[model samples]
Target chain A: MLTNEILQQRLTEKFGELVYNFEQPYGMLTFVTDRDNNLKVMNFLKESEDLGFTFLNDLTAVHYPDQLGKELAVVYMLQNIQAGLRIRFKVFTDITHPDVFTATGIFETANWLEREAYDFFGVNFVGHPNLIRIMNVEEMDYHPLRKEYPLEDQTRIDKDDDMFGR
Target chain B: MSQKQNIQLPEGSLGKQTTTLNLGPTHPATHGVFQNILEMDGERIIDAVPTIGFIHRAFEKIAEHRPYYQITPLTDRLNYCSSPINNMGWHMTVEKLIHAELPKRVEYLRVIIMELSRIADHLVCNSVIGVDTGAFTGFIYVFELRELIYEIFEEVCGSRLTTNIGRIGGFERNFSELAFQKINHFLSVFPKAMKEFETLFNRNRIFMERTMGVGGIAAERALNYGFTGPNLRATGIDYDIRTAHPYSGYQDFDFSVPVGTTGDVYDRYLVRNAEIWESISIITQAVKKIKELDPSVFHADIPDFYLPEKADVYTKMEALIYHFKIVMGETAIPAGEVYHSVEGGNGELGFYLISDGGRSPYRLHFRRPCFIYYQAYPEIIKGSMLSDAVVTMSSLNLIAGEIDA
Candidate 1:
């Protein structure tokens, strides 16, 4: 039971402005950090005995079309197995060149999770050994989960759905 | 060893090159739609690479267009073996986001349904492991009990598989007396079937030898891979989402979280078996608790979101408008971010939802346990026999729908 106040203070004491955008939506401690320092923060969280956020719960990304410069938000959820504390750690990257340092170096589980993020949202994990499409076909060109693409299937039989029900 | 000299040598490689054998995008041993290319030195597997995504239905992308209520069917397809747990997890996530208070009766009802699905899920998994270990009798017997669980589901929901059962606040309708009777019937019959299953496979020398040391991973490595549910418990980690997050009134129940020491196939099998007993205990407790409450309080008092009766829609003005709004998927959702997880059949099934005050989710991601644990497959099967690889895969209890989704 680590409180948000102590977590915020501990985070600031370790890395000052690099750990910013503090918000606790639904009482889960969420924060933003520089995309370049993705590995740096992950190493700190993993190596520190006091923090011990060694468990990499999830690593996925979200595409924001409206955001300028930083259009893709790569989120990494970390947890401490001993204390039962969870934190949503996020890093923003540019859509044109999305390159955040991979977490596979810290956690072995991040390999497929990073590949999935690359497969879906085109978030490039810079140091990843095999950065390729995981969930989609190798022949497919574009990422399917991005906001620019339509959610409807291209092979749908109902061609003119705009005329009737949405 | 002289077989190496008979083969032609490659340009720069030193040791003997291994034979490449593909174990399906369609192999029965894989237990799902998964392709693993293993480089073998005769019988020993040098390395194996798991290539997934054979059935990626793009569930997260599909959730973007669907309204809050329409997303239930999408969840049903994830882990079809235990569709009710997924349904309730999604419902609970939405309820958490909106800060909706559920009745004690609804909580007990959800616990019962979810635990029943847990039993069904474990039965499929453990029995399938028995079949993989060359014990097919147990699988056939347990499937009959699984059918009984489905009958209970059909009584509660309209459909057997892919049941879009409950609404956001609670169930769409109150449980009928037949549903209650079906639960009671299942509760009595399933335990006897379960005991027979354990007797068939528990201490059988062939079954134990096939599973005891095959595909064994240490507890530390399993934790690094973010293993949860029975798999993690098999590795001796006592982290259960029911006890951790305690959603859907799981905190009110008294059930032990079973853990294993070796983290091998046998350990996983034993862990799942112990959990089924725990789930049965939970369902019985929930039944007793639910019997105390008024039957009509199945759904919480959320009229604007819940659908009205067909007769009331024709008569009442308010019911007509509410019905029109619900059918059209026009209920205004509040903008927020919420991550809710439930103890699924496979593992901890988590739903991370971000709503931008629109009908659809801005971004929705399922923390699929199969997807996470399948990453460690290549590591576990390295240097093990090819048949042991198959045994290991099935023992992991990976459902392709959840893995690909």
Candidate 2:
């Protein structure tokens, strides 16, 4: 029954500026923060005796190409099963210089998710111990999920240049 | 820790000549184009690096071009075993973006169909796991039930495998009388079939030995890896998207979230079995609830978005106009982003869509359950035997279509 307002106030009182943007839509709480304080906030959420978000339900990324300002956004959905509450955290980064701190220390499940985001969107996770491509080939260069990638090509493919000789 | 130095191995030492084994983009056990390059030390798997993208068809890219209605068929291919749930999830996401309120009768109908699909999906998952562990008979038994379920789907949607049944507002058509009759038949026989499957695998000593503690993962570890649905619940976390966050009027139904003592292959097997029974119970309840509501109440008020009845289209000019608008996707939809999730057979299947006040979504993303679980494949199989790796992967139920999509 605790509203987002009370949760926001409690979070602000505990960590100033670290609370960031708290948006509640459809009775769900979403907090947006800078990459620098991601781990700080995650650890605080996990270890805090009061608000324990013990379960990491989902983790994924969103790329906003048109906005052009915040090109890539990573969202983490966390659930406190005991409290039956879910909260989302979004961290923004520019595509050209996409980098964010890793949450692997805070939650082990994040290791694969961070790698997946890196593989698809080319968002680099600093301090990730094993930051290799999880979905695509190790030799591949382009990130397939980037907004700039062409879905289909109308131009004819030269047989000589075609990798599979199509 | 900051020091960097060259460490050389003694002459003729165990240098970098580890044998590599490609599991598949074509092997039997790899399960649909999932290839893993395993660096081997004799029979022991030293390190395994999974190679995907073989089955990728650029679903997101295609979704960009199509209207919201056209994307439902595309989602059917994501996790093909449970296409109905994927279809429902996509529709719900679009409905959320437009802030459309579905009637209670429609919600009940959706729950019934979704629960039926969940049962079908889990049957296939458990059966496939059995097949991987050298029990072929169990696969046939469950697949028989799957065929019956598919028949019910075909009767309702006019398609068997890739059924894009529901529209944004409601279903494309109400369930036919024959479809309801077939469902009653299936419901009558399904419990006996489920018991047969449980007896064949759950009680078998060989199946137990092959699965029990084979790929044990703790609750904290499973949660960290973002496992949801049955796999997460198998680890004793009583989190079902239906219960934790109710959608489609799931709160009206009474069911229990089954949990396991240890998050092993056996625990997953048990959890799925229990889920199948729970889904059956939910489906029965939903059908009863649907019967109590007025038939007209099973539709949204948004005429422009929903297809007009064939008879109405002929008789009424307004109905014809709405039909045209529905076909062309010219229905008025708001500009917004909404992430709608359902308790998919494998896990939480989420559809996140961004609408730019257009008929077509500006951006659509499928948070596939199999994709997330496959990411943690290597980690779970670590320190497990080479053969156990295959069983572990199978038990995780990583559908390549969903993962690569």
Candidate 3:
């Protein structure tokens, strides 16, 4: 059945304490590891015939400005085709030097997915071949999705409080 | 004179003249705002690079600030070809995080609406493939049925292109008798027109020659590239989100997933054509299921999130208070993360959401299937003829809104 218990057991047995913080919020298993071993764990999960989570459903990152030291977290969502099982794994890196190894070698789809993570959250995938500003223009010199930046457009300063009866 | 000059030509001009063709950040053939810089040696494309994000609205950045309900309109712009699926997917993700319990009637209603939009989306994709191959008649014929689908959307949501139709709990209101009538009418009339449209191109010699072996991708390679929905099914893997995950009570109804073996343009077209039939069948079953249930049931009973009736809001105090609170986005949602995927027109449209017990989402990332699968375009179209590249792009059904988002 490839239940959460089975997957978690395999993950923990393979990595010991290297993989930790397991949680299942909505019937899907999620856990965390350090940025250094992110690629290794992902490759092992993909290559292991028993685990065969070959499909990379989603790859993105979440930024936590308040969390000291490890301010950036990259999330990888993988799915097993036969069992229709999905599991999420995250790796946390220091925002100042966010250099997680790239998973493009393991999953071909991760090439652009990692670039998007880098483009928005500034989580530099160390071995990315062509990491550049993908969604944003080249002239813009900031990672916009970081919590440090405000969501609303800052350049439009003309709309004062009185302008809209706010 | 010409022979001597050609032999002693400058270094820059001495190489074979390979034309650099920019086939749209603006061309009509791209269907949407996409630019593929194709390096061509005569008619054959040597290399191609696709540049997207021209219409990038920073949806992820914009989503973080908006409250959960306000984000439906944003999702409407994701795959505008099938916006309701995106809206419903977003709602389901939030519902998963908050543990919203839905009713049986609500699930069947969603199935109906979602399958209708899937048909609408495939109508454009398959017919446009025909248009790219110089068979414009099918596109013209099939698009009339898209109007019928839009009519159903208009009756349900009051909007057409970007219908913010479904609510977090369910629909904002019950389906009108007119909406049911229109859907029934569409169900009866569409298949005949669809058959006529199919007869025009299904066995046409020209379409077969243009699409048969062009832009072929292997099953293994497609999965490695994260292909989903019809594109993945075209590679013969039957890995449908509705069948695999069975979200929105898909297990109640019965429909088979149509798959193809060759993973070529013709195979993709065939898969989409068969899927339109499957969607119609699914919708018919969903309507029957909805009919068997009580007519009064629509949205789930989530009093805090779902809005009260307008009459009740005007007449009663508690209803008014709940109305004001929900409308003002003061409902207390949980702090957690959830990812939900729906079978969108293009492929698997996923919404990954994180909430921090605030009115707004802390982080929202849309796993746009087109954005992920479009990465394999240059690889698929490489070493193909220019005309074949156009046909290949149409067959892939790349929507700009979803791709850039």
Candidate 4:
């Protein structure tokens, strides 16, 4: 029942410029921010008295290769369980050197999720404790989710020669 | 391409030294082909490492080559237990990219079928948790109900496990009156069957002892792991994607999002049971609402996107041409990216689609609920007894198909 304007005002007062663009689409508030301010903004949101985004609903990445400047974006869907509000935070990163500050300190669940993001999209989470591959094996070089990976050309033939005869 | 490597334990000073055990890829406790190497000190698990990708099929890569319409069948294979929900979610994502509006009746039909699938999915979760705890009878009772639900699916889609029933814009076929009657019959029996399941396990002393306080996590920790759906709700969070963010006219249906005080295995079981009841309530309301509305309301208006009726294709040249175009997946959809998520039985099932103004999506990613929950397994079972690990993993209700996809 909380209005978007009131929520935005409270967030702005609490975290200043960290609260970037606030827009409501499909009846949920989306907050956009730069990679540099992600951890600070998340900490404030978690610890703030008025806004307690206590639950991280979902975390996933979106690739926009053709967009003029930003090539990759990671969207985090956060939920304040007490207030029943869901807000989405998006951090834009350059595909070449995609790195973002980790939120594992604030939310313990991000430990594996950040690893997954790192494995699939090759986005580095700078402060993660163990950022090694979670889904893919350690030696695999390419990030499968990146647009340049060319899904079609990755032969249907078995890549693991040990398991299947060539 | 290296030979299988053996894990070597360090030279030990005494029994207190660390002992390493590889628990899966064939172990009985592992429900699927999941392998976990654990460092243990006697009965306590010290550190656990999970290695997956055993059943990886590279689905996203294959989707890029297929046309928009052909991908529906591929989505069905992601979470094989709840195939219809995945199919509907994929269709909705494509619909969002194209900005196509589905008819009200079609939405209601989707609600009915999807809620039915939710009940089926939760039945497996509850029953499988019982099986993992050495209760075999519970599995049979719940699976019987699941079989009845699958019978309805087989009648409607002509396939049980992988039902590729949805087209791009709407459904491939409207629910026949017979299918509706069967669904009504299933609903009539579902509540009683649920009560029977609860009676069998809800208060059983052994079941409670195994699950009530095992593998618990706080709300804050659960949030950080990006847990969604019932597992997150079990952590006392009242966030349901359906109620928090309504999609497919879910706002019209009246239901409650169950929450628990402790995020334990028992809480997870109770929450899923409550959800089965809520799903039944939603399906009943949807069936009634759909029957009242006109049947034509179930069909979307985009002829180019929707497959032409068989009779129309035979009688009209334009219909034949459109049919050919749809079959070839040559229709040009506007370029855009859309994330469409629905509350799947396990958790939030999301489809993130990127279209490049082409026939096929340039990129497609699935935010699978199982993958997120399974990733948290090591942390949840840390320091607990080895037996509790099986209980915890089953309570998480992970589907290997979804996790690997």
| Local lDDT at B372 for model 2 | 74
Ranking of predictions according to lDDT: 3, 1, 4, 2
Name model 4 segments beyond 4 Å from true.
Answer: A1-33, A62-70, A81-89, A152-166, B1-16
B1-405, model 3: which lDDT tens digit per residue?
Answer: 123334566667645567899999899998999999889988989898888889999999888888888899999998999998998998888888889989999998899899999999999999999999998899888888999999999999899999999888999888999999999999999999989988998899999999999988999999999999899899999999998998999998888999999899999999999999999999999888888899998888888988888999999999999999987988889898888898899898998888898888899999999999999999999989999999999999999999899
From the highest TM-score down, the ranking of the candidates is 3, 1, 2, 4
CAPRI class assigned to model 1: high
For model 2, how does the per-residue alpha-carbon lDDT over B212-300 read when each residue is reduced to its tens digit?
Answer: 98888888778777788888888898878898778888889999999997989999989999989998998888777778888656568
Off by over 4 Å in 2: A18-21, A66-69, A132-144, A157-166, B1-19, B296-298
Candidate 4: residue pairs that collide: A109-B224, A109-B225, A110-B224
Candidates 1 and 2 compared by DockQ, better number: 1
Give candidate 3's error at residue B41 in angstroms.
Answer: 1.5
- lDDT tens digits by residue: candidate 2, A35-94: 777777777778887788876666677778876768999887776777778777888888
Q: Per-residue alpha-carbon lDDT of model 3 for A14-131, expressed as tens digits?
A: 9999999999978889999988898888888889999999999999999998889989999999999999999999998888899999988888899899889888988899888888
lDDT of all predictions, in order shown?
Answer: 0.89, 0.82, 0.91, 0.82
- Best-first order by DockQ: 3, 1, 2, 4
Per-residue CA lDDT of model 1 for B1-405, tens digit only, reads 455466666888777467999999898877778899989989999988889999999999999988889999999999998999999999999988878889999999999989989988999889988888788899999999999989988998888889998898898788999998999999888889888889999999999989998898888899888888899999898989898778888889999999999999999999999999999999999999887888789787777677887899999999999899878877777898889989999898899999998878999999998899988999999989988988899889898999989
CAPRI quality level assigned to candidate 4 from its DockQ score: acceptable
Task: Tell me how far the alpha carbon of residue B189 in candidate 2 is from the true structure, in angstroms, after superposition.
Answer: 1.4
TM-scores, all candidates, are 0.96, 0.90, 0.97, 0.88
Off by over 4 Å in 1: A153-166, B2-16
